[model samples]
Target: MSQLYVAVLAIIVAVLLAVALYRATRVKTKADYLVAGRSLPAAVLVLTLLTSWIGAGSLFAGAENAYKNGFAALWQPAGGWLGLLLIYFIAPRARKFAQFTLPDLLEARYNQTARVLGTLAILFAYVGITSYQFKGGGDVLHLIFPDTVSSQLGTYIIALFVIVTTALAGMSSVAYMDVAIGSLVTCICIISAPSLLHQAGGWSALHSSLPPQYFEIFGNYRLSPHGVLQSPAMGLVRALEFLVPTMLLMLGNQVMYQKFFSAKSERDARNSVIGWIIGTVVLETLIVAIAVFGRALYPTGEVAQHPREIIPYTARHGLPAILGAVLLGAVFAKVISTASNYLFSPATNLVNDVFVRYLAPNASNKRVLIVSRLAVVLLGCWALYQAIYAESILQKMLWAYTIYSAALTPVVLAAFYSKRVTAWGAVAAIASGTVVTLAWDLPGVKSLFPHIISDRDAIFPALFVAIAALIIVSLFTPAPSEAQLAQVAE
Candidate 1:
């Protein structure tokens, strides 16, 4: 059975690589390499966005949440659904202001200092995101081939695959391949859930066998010895910790904006959000359902210790041979698609935002392409280093999401809507948010404010400080110049 799953995954990857190489032939200029030459249609944009958003983060971290807390895991994705409603309004605007990277928007709306600081924050957050995709891909690989591939080697192998694929054709490969992977995974997940539920002897068995709280919205709290709920406050707080980061990431993700910029038109970009919202809500709910059902069948053992493996474990061991193979292959391909998108985004940032902008303004097309591929290699290595020390993909996912949410989201959204925000204020906001999020998670800093920072994640305090800086500083300083405001007014 494991061999069958391996064979299926190998074939899927080969097909994807073939497609990537074919696309590579078309990537001649920097625009073709970075944004698919700004030619993606609505359907392509929809699937690519779905694929990038629902990667290892949803498959592993979110599945782990459902395995442990049941249906309550919906809270994590609910945040994104809410954000998508807002994105529907922002997508066309973002496309109209089309540029290669988010830092470009920062520089146009604010100043070069804001651009540089935003690039740093994006690297801090995105490298962390790309790191866990490696870890998650490694987990899926190690789960199936445990006898031969250790998790550590699995991480290195997956990282190399992603780096090569991303460096091959850039967005041309990542965006189009996502259409295939996203559609396949959506169907597999929707079909697998009910089948898994029926195999587990139905929902009645799940209800009877699992804890009652598993069905509840806030399923993460504990009970007292006397059987009373003891930590409702903490449980709600925990849910918010999951909720905030996801909402913020979706709203301000550079990957998403870059995808929008790739659209054929502003209409294509706007239409894609509608498809993305529906696909995201349905697929994410199915993922939580599949994991919840998996928990019922394999209630203990290895899955209990490492709940993130629940989806793959159930697919390999609990489902029928053919279904399991396809499902596992879908998961493997989804991880690759996401890793390529994320790894490519930061590479573009370094090249377009920094290298071309400052270091080599007169560089040729061939030179820019060379630098772009090298940037992918260097950033990918950094993420691989993080993957080596990372114990929990869920923890890393939330940490990265919080950093981007607090540091970048506020400023990104303000750029679109608020003309009064000055360049200095944008710089202050970005710096404060980035610093607070990074510091709040440090061992020494958490030890100092255990009450406020111990149980909670960094989004709350960091976002507060960021918003305060944007508002208070902008009011005291002169408003943004008319030219600066016009830059983002599209």
Candidate 2:
């Protein structure tokens, strides 16, 4: 029942998973391997979306907010469900468009300039997000081990595991692995949630033992009127930060779009979004509970302790040894599967959309696949290094969402809804959004612009400016020729 033994059990599960995925997937056809042959059934697609979306970010970040804010923290996840709602309406259209990545769709909708710019935007966003997951996995591994294993070494191992698996079969491998991990994780969460509550002495016990503010929605003024700016707490702003990125997620981005591509049909893709939304509502609530309980159980002042460790710490003490061990493995499964799936998407996009299409349009699919595998290694290394140097788990998740949303969301949305969007518009939107967001931490910048103004205005302003420029320019300029217009309609 030692934590060390529990940790060992988790590693064994991951190893077994790797071996099983390696044997099950024998990649040859690019379509079959990179995207599950573009024929994923509803069941597999649903579960994979569920697993891929809810990584350490949900478990750790959700837990952190729950720990810090109590029941009011539930609003954090409520925002994500809103995102899933948006996805349901948007996904089928994306799939019907039949593209490799979001940028692929934009290229068809607008022009090559749009495609190229969107691709660059996603690369920055995804790498930043994936890097955090890399860092989180490494941190978790180091915590699972001790003196015999250094944190840096542990990070490298987890990073390697992710990079190697992603390189194996692209989305094809990520999908099947997601199904298994998602199901296992679902069972673990169901088991762990109740036990965590029990350790807190049941719902009534948890309800009464805390500060009076624990149960309030605005416990810390997070949702207050002033929350948008000049507020003492991060409540409203945090919620906005969570909301805007998720809104973009529902609109653009390859991760969700790929799910749409892999769906058996339009119905399946739409249904999967609803299913994921439902699951997010339930699981996020459960994670929030675990985080609150964890807060009460393990306070500060340990040699090594942080909020992300809350789930593991509580499971080791609050649940029976065997059940705790199983849940622990599920935690790792959540982290690794997400890392594997996310890292693969951008790599594939880079090779197929940018490298093969622009660099050498006539390159065989086989060669493109090989290049994709290499991109996975190169990107994976970048993510792994950042993961080691990064702080706790939640920040990385935010980093990626912020960058991607600010850059790609506008351009992605423009593709589907705006007929006037042009290549120049796409380029301008990406450049403006990225510049504003990246300079967010600058000294004079914050004072001049401030997080309040800078945050809201950054992406949205860039998006609108891009749209206006595209419309004005396209009006004066000739529209797409009939042939290009045909491609756009398709």
Candidate 3:
């Protein structure tokens, strides 16, 4: 059975590599490498967007949340669903402002300082995200070949393959490969969810076997022995911690914006979001359901101990042979798809925002392409290093999400909607947000105000400081000039 799963995964990797190689041959210019020549249609855009957004974050971290918290886990993804509502209004405008990377938009609307600060924040957030995808892929590989492959070895294998594949054709390969992978994973999850429920003896069995709190919204606190139900405010705070970061990340996700830049037209970009919202809602709900069912089926043992592995463990032991193999393959491929998208985004930032913009404004297309590939290899190694030391998938996911949410989202949204936001204010927002988030959990800093910082998640403080800086500083300073405002004007 393990060998069958390995064979399916091996086949998927081969097909992905072949597609990547074919796409590599089509790369000719900087635009071709970074934005797929700005020619992707709505159909392709939808799948790529869906695949990029639903990653190890969904498969591992999200599954872990479901295993532990039940339906209340939906609060995390509910944030993304809400962000998608706002994105429907922003997508067409983003396409109209097409550029290579988010930093490009930042510089146009803010200043060079804001652009550089934004780039740094993106690197911190995105590299952390890519690292966990490596970790998740490694977990799946170890599961499939446990006798011979340790999780550490699996991490190295996944890192090497993802780096090489991402360096091959850039956005063209990533986007097209997603079309294949996203379809497989979406179909498999749709099938696996109902199948797993039936095998678990249906929803009636699930409710009876699991804690009754598992079925309630915000039931996360209710399961605790201390019974925090006495403090509903704390429950709301806990739920908001999950909700805000996911929503903010979606609103300002550079990966999503880059895909919009790749779209052939504004219509394509807007249309893609409609499909993306539907796919995301359906897929995320299924992921949580599958995880909850898997928990009920396997009440104890290894999976119960390491809840992050529930999805893959269910694939190996819970499902039938053929479906299990395919579902396992989908999990593996989705991780790679996400890692490539994230790894490629930061590389795009370094090459387009720093190297090409400042270091070699006159560099030839050939030279830029070479540097682009090199950046992917270097950043991928950085992500692999972080993966090596990472402890929990859900912890890493929230940390990365909060960094991007607090640091970049405020300034990015201001650029699109407010002419009163001056460049210095944007810089202040980015700097304060990044610093507070990174420092909020440190032992020394938490000790300074243990009551406020120790127990609370960083998103609340980080986002507050960021927004306050943006609004207060902008009000004190002169309004942005017409020139600055014009850059982002719709």
* Overall lDDT per candidate, in order of appearance: 0.91, 0.70, 0.94
Candidate maximizing lDDT: 3
Q: Write the per-residue lDDT of candidate 1 for residues 1-490, one digit (tens) a residue.
A: 7679878988888888898999999999999999999999999999999999999999999999898788889999999999999999999999999999999999999999999999999999999999989988898888889898887898999999999989988999999889989999999998899899998889888899889999887885444324567577767777888898899999999999999999999999999999999999999999999999999999989889999988988998888899998998898888898989889999999999999999999998889999999999999999999999999988899999998999999999999999788888899999999999889878999889887777667888899999999998888888888888887787
Residue-level lDDT of model 2, residues 154-195, one tens digit each, is 668777888877787777778877888888878788888877
Off by over 4 Å in 3: 222-230
Off by over 4 Å in 2: 3-25, 221-235, 303-305, 443-490
Backbone clashes (count) for model 2: 4
Clashing pairs in 3: none
The candidate scoring highest on TM-score is 3
Comparing 1 and 3 on TM-score, the stronger one = 3
Report lDDT (Cα) of residue 329, candidate 2. Answer: 68
Clash pairs, candidate 2, are 32-37, 135-387, 222-235, 222-236
Ranking by TM-score: 3, 1, 2
Question: Cα deviation of 314 in candidate 3 (Å)?
Answer: 0.3
TM-score of predicted model 3?
0.98
Q: Candidate 1: misplaced stretches above 4 Å? A: 221-228, 231-233
